[model samples]
Target: MRAELVVIGAGPAGLAASLAAAARGTRVVLVDAATETGGQFYRQPAAGLRAGRPEALHHRWRTWERLRDGLAASSVRVLTDHHVWCVERTSVGFTVHALLGPEQEEPAEVHARAVLLATGGYEHVLPFPGWTLPGVVTAGGAQAMLKGALAVPGRRAVVAGTGPLLLPVATGLAAAGVEVVALVESTGPGRLARRGRALAGKLPEGAGYAARLLRHRVPVLARHTVVRAHGDDRLTGVTVAALDTDGRVRPGTERQLPCDTLAVGHGMLPHTDLAEGLGCGLDGLAVAVDAEQRTDVPGVWAAGESTGIGGAALALAEGHIAGCSAAAHLRGTAPGPAPAALKARTRLRRSAAALDAAYAPPAHWPEQVTDDTVVCRCEAVTAGAVRDALGLGAGDERTVKLLTRAGMGWCQGRMCQAAVAGLTGCPPTPSRRPLARPVPLGVLARQHTQEELS
Candidate 1:
């Protein structure tokens, strides 16, 4: 496939960008890995599921409806179930290499004059004891199951995490007929109160979740953390403990909460694999983009959570700006995004910063991990093994991975990088992987042969 602009993601950002660019007379191709248009924020239940009221599971339903209807009426071509593995720079433009569907064996490519990356972000699930158990799902995973599958994780559950995401997960599960035991938050109320002014716009949304929690009669355990999960084969319960002012577990304050499911997450990190593969620089852990959402690369732009983890509102604003900029550049006109979008971006970014400061994970989280606890589930590397590497003069994440193979598994450290950094007291570094996802050897060989023939 070929187009003037390619928007890589079907989420709020990509959808907005595609619509904007298409309206401005630019040929746009919107690509995504899912079977449908909406990204995780607006994930839809399969048509076979016959969902009666899917809107009940999500917020901003009217906005989603507008985007959905606009997509159906637009000229932009939509390609779903295309799992992009890499993007290569060509003399003419760029070639996006992808695999098809769940099988991920067939090769496909999209050539475009310019690329806009709205790849979104992934949940950060810091490991603890019994975390690898079947019922111990990430908070986002539970939400995904509920939204995409119309299914709950378990009858009884505890939503434990230190981010804004935990609020909705706790209430959503409870509303879905699950018995929510409690909502455990490691950060105290005082932290949020400190940033009250900056997060004023989010107060209404926070109040809504708070009202839902009140309606469900779920207990809110503030300044508490899940020290360990107790289970044999699956999750039966988790041990919760109070955190002191210093973010340490208070001695003798541990309590066991019996529940069938433990939905836990610390935070989220941006998905920058494609951007990094294309040699785009990053600001901290997210892709670096200018006010117009253009990257340092000449023909590349980025927006949404791939740029940083703000909510859907910021993403939409950024996407609109990027689309306008790209369309103007392509058509030899001046960029003219709506002033409202520019204002929204500035306001939402400030609120996002406040939320990040208020929802940081507990400082002494790694101290609670027992020696036998597995840090890297894919590699089955234990905390003891990482500590042994530390004893052998491994002072960094790279050295520790080299010594114990903690990050050499299928995920290539996506799940364990944060935990390893916490354990080693070193900051996590971005992995400059060539391919965003693993490709089949046969498909790669075929691609090589095709290149030679051409």
Candidate 2:
């Protein structure tokens, strides 16, 4: 397939970018791994479910409908079920490599003159004892299951973590008829009050979730952190303790809550593999972008969570500016300023920063990790192994990974990097894989043979 511009990911950012570019007369192709258009935020229940009130699962349903309708009305070509693995620059433009089937064994390529990467983000998992147990899942994972499949993870649940995400997950579970025993938040409510001016815009949404939790009769245990998850084969309960002003757990405040499931998450990190692989600069773990949302690399732009962990509104603002810039550049014209979008972007970025500062995970949470606790779920590497690696003079994530195989698993550190970094007293580093995702050796060999024959 060929296009003037290709937007990867069908989330809010990608969807908005594709439509904006197409509306400006640019031939656009939108690609995504999911069969449905909405990203995690607007995740839809399966078609087989025949959900009577699909809108019940989302907060931004109306905004999603607008984007969906706009896409249907635009000239943008959308390719669903295409899991893009890598994109390479060519003399003419670029080539996007993807797997086109359920097995993801078949290679498919799309050529475009310009590319927009809005590949979205994933939950940030912080490990404590029994984190790898069967019934433990990320807060986002549990939300996705309910929103996309009309399924609940377990009958009895405890949603534990810091950040605004816990509120929605707790309410969502309660609405889904689960027995939510408690909502354990590590941050103190006083911190949120301190940021009232910055968080003022979010009060309405927060209040709604709070009201839902109140109506559901679920207890909100603020200033608390999970010490350990209990049960041998699965999570049957979790022990939580209150935190002091200095970020230490207060003595004698420990309590055990029984539940069949634990949905835990601290926050999120950007999906920067493709951006880093393309040699684009990064601002911390996020892909670095300019005012136009253009990456350091020419002919490439990135928006959404790939840029940072701001929510859908910020993604849309950034996507609009990026799409406008890419379309103008392709037309051999100077990109005009998107004043409205820029203003929204500026405001939302501040709100996002406030969220980061106010909802930061408790500092003492890592102290709860026991030697028996697994840090890297993929390699089954324990915290003890990571500590041992540190004792072996490993001072960074790379050395620890090399010594303990902590990040050598299939996920390639996406799930465990932060915990590993925290354990080793090193910062998380950017990963620049040769390919965006792993491919079967047979596929690479066949491509090699084809190249030789050509």
User: Each model's C-alpha lDDT?
Assistant: 0.93, 0.90
lDDT of 1 by residue, 309-400 (tens): 99889999999999888888889888974899999999999999999998999998889888999998889999999999999999888999
Runs of candidate 2 with Cα error greater than 4 angstroms are none
Model 2 C-alpha lDDT per residue in residues 155-190, reported as the tens digit of each score: 999999888788889999999999999999988889
TM accuracy, model 1: 0.99
Q: List the residue pairs that clash in candidate 2.
A: none
Local error of candidate 1 at residue 171 (angstroms): 0.6
**Model 1 lDDT, residue 122, Cα:** 94
List residue ranges in candidate 1 displaced over 4 A. none
* Candidate topping TM-score: 1
Best model per lDDT: 1
